[model samples]
Target: MNKAKNVTISVYSILLFSIALYTLATLIYSLIPNIPVNKLFAMIVAFTILYLYIQRITLERIIILLFCLFFSIYTTIISEYSSDNINDLLWIVTTVLIIGIASDQKFRSGLEQAIKRNKKWMKMIIIVIELILLMAVITPSSYGNDVGWGKDASYFVGFATHSHTLASACCLLIVLIMTVYKDKKISLMEYAYYILPIYSILFSGARTFLISVLILIMINVYMKKNSKLMRNMTLLVILSSFIFALFNSSMISKFEFTSNNVYAKNMLDSITNGRSEFWKYDLDLFFNSNFFIQLFGRGFEYIYNYNYLKVGIKIWAHNDIINNLISIGLIGTLGYVYIWFKYINNFFKRPRIDFSKVQFIIFMLFTLYIVAPMLLNGLYQYQHYIFSSVLLGQLISQRD
Candidate 1:
């Protein structure tokens, strides 16, 4: 009884500490607009290491994490690099995840209870957050959606190199929503909750994202039943895509935001330069650059800057497989693939879905979906990193 009580208290304290620390960091980031966010992250990681060592944590776990760290660093150094800094960032994130897995394991019982407490509220919270953020984005100044039609585009708010990236993110979010809530019954209010964002997605005017939505809808319907719903969704997807293309082909027809974005256009433009030339150039760069890179990998998306597009040389090597090859090489990205398949096997074929199973399934589906886009195009860099990390954190939390 004493041991259980002690363990429970320790778990509560840890959860409290985590939330407090995150809140502090978020506040600091908002306050200090000039300091790079990564610097703050580095500080947190350094603090975690010190805290764990002081707490007399087991050396065995640390050693395993160190192995992961070595592989992470090893991968980072070998792959084709657009900029040394982004490569470092990739390795840092990977290492941090390793650490998170170890740290979160200590107080698993209490944390698991707390996580399960939100079953009813989670979907509502997500919907509310999305609406608030969307209103902020679409309104910009909050005056109103006035002046001109598309100029309401914030016409100038450049997030990633491409204007269409947000639409792609919306598509990805929709996939997740469908995955989580497809047949599950909620309420009429919840059904309305999903409809609004989707309507917003249609208005976002991203052809490829629309295509992805179509694919997700078809698959979802197929899973439920190969009936009229599947046929209707397929028909709607085609018609919607066609209508979007007919009206807004010009949105991506020329595709020129890289040079104009805050993050210099050099790298983004290079990747967008198209298959024939960009792949030819990047492939030679990946394979011939180093023997080690060819053997294992450099790391995921380490190539940062060479992805630019010139005016005359409008090209694109946006395919994910080609990009992964150039950046992580064969061996590195394959681990990601292995992880996905492993999780998928457990999610569908396995008998149970207690906490860890659901998280694993979510991550696997997301990781696989991101990989799928690589063959077609490359609009995933920004969103993939964040969502993959989110899913990974959830898994680590559950395992704890």
Candidate 2:
């Protein structure tokens, strides 16, 4: 029985490590811009899931996975079935299966125990992520030119398709590091690890993530009293440096503070960065459509088929809520919202250790990072979903 348990734990460890590797590779592809890293990683993940399924078939896991698969198939059949739509459908199915596996009681327990036993490997993963981000920061590329820091320098995308994704990943990384740090006093090197990711988010020039990180830092300061001085000083330095960088870069020119009205107008414009226009167009399209279209949505290919804005941009709704409504209709949007609420409720209800107070706060902050821009952006990519699932699994794991 002990040997069997060891094997189970080893299998789970390998699964999680593979997921992390996939995420890292995806980030690297973003920086290099030539590799089909995500596709290759997706194939590996699919096979891993198949292996897990064949090794341990359970009624509950199958039911949940099938529920997600049903939606994927339904949406694909309803849409134009273009490569993009099919890829999206596949990603959704994969995400669901991964979440289902991570959430399984036995699997999650074994995974957590395996992780605890393999702290060095986990640390190596973090180191790899940090090194990749460092490489992205140093490497020059044309990415993020559209909404990134003006022509002066490209906003940091850091192995992500966009700045926002990088910011979101950074936010998630910070939360994970902080969760670990909360258990014990971390060295200055570890503190640097936390700072690097936060700095990367700032460098990305993603307003939503920057704002979320600020709020998180403030809350951390208030909640943690043991190392108050050092924490505040570090935060102060980070904020000061970020402000200095913004003023030195082209970002300052985008803001107008000549007067209160100008300041307000510019602030709104800067924050929204024309996203309000996208939202307005999406809302108009949704409202002006026929009953069936509005209720059931025009499918995922709606934006590609119908250009309500006439902007010629191939992308559809920029906002997650609006995108869901436009792509999946009202029915799907409600279900989407319910899933998030249920996840949050379940997370809070789970029994946790004393350290969970800090963990909960970090989780909420991460959720805000996920939820805030999602109001203006679409669903997070596959890597983000995997990272989120891992965090959720850790949170839901039985107390050690």
Candidate 3:
């Protein structure tokens, strides 16, 4: 039993280590962009997670492996086995493992045990992440120079590859911190830590994060079932946010990046940052496809090629509903619908709110996710994958 427990903890540590390494690599990449940090980290974490997963495989695990294999073969065959097939396979495998690890009851339990077993190591990892988040705002980075919003719309990406990446990371960090510290009353000094991610999101210039966070705040406040500390902190955020908005209208107005675009007067284009165009284009393609293709999806390779051929840009639909319709089809999109149904079902079945519970965090994260992916290619992004795993894990591990 002890041996098995230790193995579980070890696997959990590997996941945590991967996240830490990824963040550290991002920071290092800002200084030395040519380093093979990404390659090394991917190879190391991939091998470790795959080995651990196979060693403890069950019938259910075999079924999942077989499904992934089948999907890979189908997509590869359909797409003529392009190089992108390899990347798609890796992404699917990593996503499976992330969600699998999170959903394991023994693994989740071992997280607490591991914290007690080696507090220093866990604290070190947390401290490293905290420092990185702080650096994202205080020092900032030069890499997030995006002209998509507008030529003059410069963003503060910090150590992340893009402004959106930094914004997503900040959102994830906020949820994780709140979930971890849910049971305790955070001191005023400790509560100040929330400002780091909040400010980081603003400077990153991702309105998706801004709007999503606002919705989360509204839901939490309306429920009004959180801890005293959480309530107080939420109130503090509201007060400070008002003050900041009042004094820093110029900074807040930076989100209006579509002011100079041809669609400047178009409400839909302005609000969606022009994603509605991509969404409509992809939806048209999906509708024009044969019934079978519409049911099962056109596959990622097909969508990639089709988008490039149509617009000379290899990109997604920027909307998960449309992305899923084209890539995974209506059948796969229904899986997402089921997830929503389950969350809403659970929400209404309860007499009171989960409040600052991990479930609450998961609910809020999912809420934000539903909004972000509509305008950004967020469904398949690594940061969202990590948080999706946490959300899935919480949903699966908990009982009605």
Candidate 4:
């Protein structure tokens, strides 16, 4: 019985790891266009099978799942179905369910142990992802020419939907690698590995990610021992300067301020870009709506409809918090905020001495990743939510 149970656990571990890698890889592989449909179907099937085989149906899990289901159904009923809204709704439901499963104490422990036990494999996976991004940078054929919302250039999209997505993925991967090897002494080669994703972020021209990485590096320098921290910081500065020189034109263009007003220009030069106008419009719409719409949102379709008709631009709210308030309403937004607060609070309550330098770095980066986007970019991307779910699972499992 013991042997059989061990074998089952091992199989589930492999399945879970494969799903995570596949989800990440699809960011690049999705450039093929037709492959995403099949890939997504396969991922859903695998996840369902894994959940059924490994997870025990408990009251808590059931309640959480039901809550997700209810929200999904509510969203569907309140709004007319469009492909984008349907996709967003599906992603939310899937993410909530995964988080629910991951919150299971036993499953979280098992998953964390499995990851630790297979560090070598995890390292290989990270390296592979880095290589994919590198390849995307070197070969123009790997990325599409359509500039979704970012500037048009030979920017590296890697396997992501856009340059920003690629930058976000690289940033997240850097934090994950740091978390995985937080205690171990990293060698020169490993440092080079870290540079790969940093360069990818630079080449992708993601200012938000660049700012976030710089903040993270500064935090590391402050938190670590004097000599070693200075050495690492100096190395990072040198590497960053080299990359910036290589992509001077792109960097300059991104930083160029078009506004004449000093404060507006400064704000635009920062991560806000043109998002302030969008946010203002969204806020106006939300406020002017009826009581029901204000309380429970006007749905995803409402945003596009309002924008196209009034603002002359067919775009969703670029801010996540605003978007959530506009789409899911006050109830859903409050619930989401409550869960986020609980997770962050729980994480800090853990003993400070128990965390390594890298772990602390991960915590800071994750916090920035979650918070930064709420002000500028919407977190409608399923892959990002899925990644967050896994990270939260690992963090929660650390509780004794």
Candidate 5:
């Protein structure tokens, strides 16, 4: 039994390491411009690692697998055999399978232990890579989105595919730091390391990422130091004030705020950053669809094509709920919500009054890093989802 447990730990550690390697390869590919095989090679490797463990199944795993199988067949029957559809189908299969494996109690237990054993180096390596990526900000991407709408490439994409990607990656890295450190006090220098990722998110021009990370930090600190209520509250208040001032500062003000860009003509547009328009479109499609489409929904490729045709540009509903409604339909969305309910229930079933526990910390991190971003930015297909699935699994594995 001990040998089996050790073997489980070792295998999980290898899987985590494989994911880290894939992420590193992605970062390198971003830096080196035209790599021969490209980032897909790394993604394929990571997926292959997870795919090999598919035989480790449970009732939940079977349901998730069936969900994927149903959608694949439904898509094939209804949609054309286009590359976009095929790629979307593959992505759905991969994501659900990852979540399925993560939902397994045994797998989650092994992975949680693996993360605990290796988190120190994991935190250090991720922060170092984050710093490296930040330095690359000076060398702008050839096609970085111009927040000014035509003025210049002011958004700091750094070495990422987009500004949002860099910001999102930084948020995930911060989660790693929180998970490893837990409620432990650290030196001033270690605290300063937190600023590096925060700064990266600020410059990346992802408004949602910035807000979410700040909230995450405050919540994390508050939970850990809640015993000293007054002191921690004071600290969080001061931190919030500083962040508010930083946004209003002259330096940050120079770059046009994403919401204040030329595209936003009115108050509602500015507040939503034009996402309301996309959401409205998606909602209309959902409401107007026939029974079959409403029940199973059109696939993501269909949404992409629909958006392109209607708007003359490719745009997704930035919100996941709406995105899922139109892309996967009511039944599929309900299935997804069911999975979320199960995982969420698992996390909260045995809440520790001492929120500093690693399981609780991981739950918070997953909520902030994965759930929030996916809901706000339609990041269901984000690269970080791979790693976040492990976090989700870890959260679900907790029994007490």
Candidate 6:
């Protein structure tokens, strides 16, 4: 019996190492400009999971994981018929493992210990940042006239693929430093940290990214208001946003490079850049399937592979809600709501932990996710995935 238990622990320990590797690799990816980022990251995480199975699986965690697996399976089934084959249902499985690990007391202790050791590591991180900045400063290519990626109005920026993500990270980091860094009062540097991401998101110019972040900024400030400056900043953002809307057509005209081709703005006329019309047509392809599919789904095979060869539009629904409805029906929507509410309930019930600014900032990032741009479109996925994961981590870990 003891040997069996030892074997179980060993399995889980390996799995834990995988998770740790994933987290570390993710941090590096967040910092670096470009690499074989996402696919490699996923592979590393999967290997980590294999290592983690050394520990005996808790029955509670198993139940949680099963719930996710079934949920994903059901999504595949729906998409099989509806043809809205989205892989988001995989989030359930991922969430179960992430939350289960986060729930562990030892994990929480390790996090606290890391924070304590930050003085030693933080110096290295600072040096690295300074070195990176210096490289950018010295590189002759940095200031050169840019290649236009085959279009006239194309402008390149420093951010890698996930601008919204970087923006959200900056936002959260600023808030954390502002609120949680013990004994540090607000200063010019801190103020810049707070505001830079919000500015960066606006400049990112992805409609989904911009709207989602703005909405969250509004809500977060409303909840954690402490000064007239924040209140004024919020008001100015609203005014500027309204002006931006009125000048939307001009903004389109100004970006002549994107204006000429596949990326041109249609004034948000059709939600998926006319893909919704295709989806409306594709929904007919299901051919009157009954009962289970109408309720849960047909399966994953249909969503990713099916094609509307005749029409120019062949891609899937860019809207999350519509996609969920097609794949999981009303039940999936309810499940999502339950998940959100579950976190909210947990947030309210947990004893106070003084995370200060970071808490509010991270919380706001979550708000931006649902209420803002994510609601509008699905183009900015990598941002959502990471931000959402961190939010989940904070909730389950009950971190301060």
Best model per lDDT: 5
Identify the leading candidate in terms of TM-score: 5
lDDT of 4 by residue, 330-399 (tens): 7767766655556555555555447766556656655665667556666545354345436543743352
Better model by TM-score: candidate 3 vs candidate 6? 3
State residue 332's C-alpha deviation in candidate 6, in Å: 5.2
TM-score per candidate, chains pooled: 0.54, 0.76, 0.77, 0.79, 0.81, 0.58
Candidate 2's residue-wise lDDT over 1-400, tens digit each?
A: 9998877777766765665666576667655677777577667767677667767878866775556665676677688859756665565456556655654566667766766776677677788888887777677772356652444445666667777666666765664554344445435765678666776666666656656667555544434445657766766876786677656642343332112222123445445665565566778888998887777676676765554435445665656688767776786666566555555455456655454565576556646645665575555343554454455446433423
**Candidate 1 vs candidate 6, TM-score winner:** 6
| Candidates 1 and 2 compared by TM-score, better number | 2
- Model 2 has an lDDT value of 0.61
**Candidate 3: Cα lDDT at 386:** 52
Better of 3 and 4 by lDDT: 4
Instruction: Predict model 1's lDDT versus the native.
Output: 0.44
Better of 4 and 6 by TM-score: 4
Task: Estimate, for each residue in 1-400, the C-alpha lDDT of model 3 and write its tens digit.
Answer: 9897677777656655565455556544555677857546656666666676687788756765665566666666676666555665565456555444444455556545543455456446556777876665566345345546555545677776776666666655554444444334434544465666666666666666676555444433433446767776776878677457634632354556654445334677666665666567788998999999888776666767777776566766666677768866786566544544444345434555445464565465555655455446545445443553353334323422
Which candidate model has the greater TM-score, 1 or 5?
5
Tens-place lDDT per residue, model 5, 1-400, is 9986787678777776655654555445566777723246435634554554564655656678788779888877777778767766665566566654555566666777878899877876776676676567445452355544334535556666666666656655655665566545533544566675676666656666755666556545543433566546656674885577557532264344545755555777666666666666778999999998899888767777877776555766777678778777898788766665565555556545344564466466555655676667765555554454455345334423
> RMSD, each candidate, Å?
8.7, 4.8, 4.7, 4.6, 4.2, 7.6
Question: After superposing candidate 4, which stretches have Cα over 4 Å from the reference?
Answer: 1-8, 11-16, 37-42, 45-60, 99-104, 142-145, 148-153, 215-249, 257-271, 351-365, 385-389, 392-400
Candidate 1 lDDT, tens digit per residue, 1-400?
9896665555444443333233223222323556545344534544544454445456754654554466557664655544454544454344343334433444344434544543344454456435643553555442222222233232311122233444444453444354345444333443345453444444444434545554444444333323556546655764665566435543332233322433234664433333444666667767676777775554554444454532233233466556656555675446444443443343334344454543454445444554555455653343333333333334333331
What TM-score does model 1 achieve against the real structure?
0.54
Backbone clash pairs for candidate 5 read none
Better of 2 and 6 by TM-score: 2
Mark the regions of model 2 whose C-alpha exceeds 4 Å error after superposition.
Answer: 30-35, 46-63, 95-107, 141-153, 158-161, 172-182, 215-270, 288-295, 304-309, 351-363, 392-400
Indicate the residue-level lDDT of 34 in model 5: 78
User: lDDT of each structure?
Assistant: 0.44, 0.61, 0.58, 0.60, 0.62, 0.44
- Cα deviation at 131, candidate 6, in Å, is 7.2
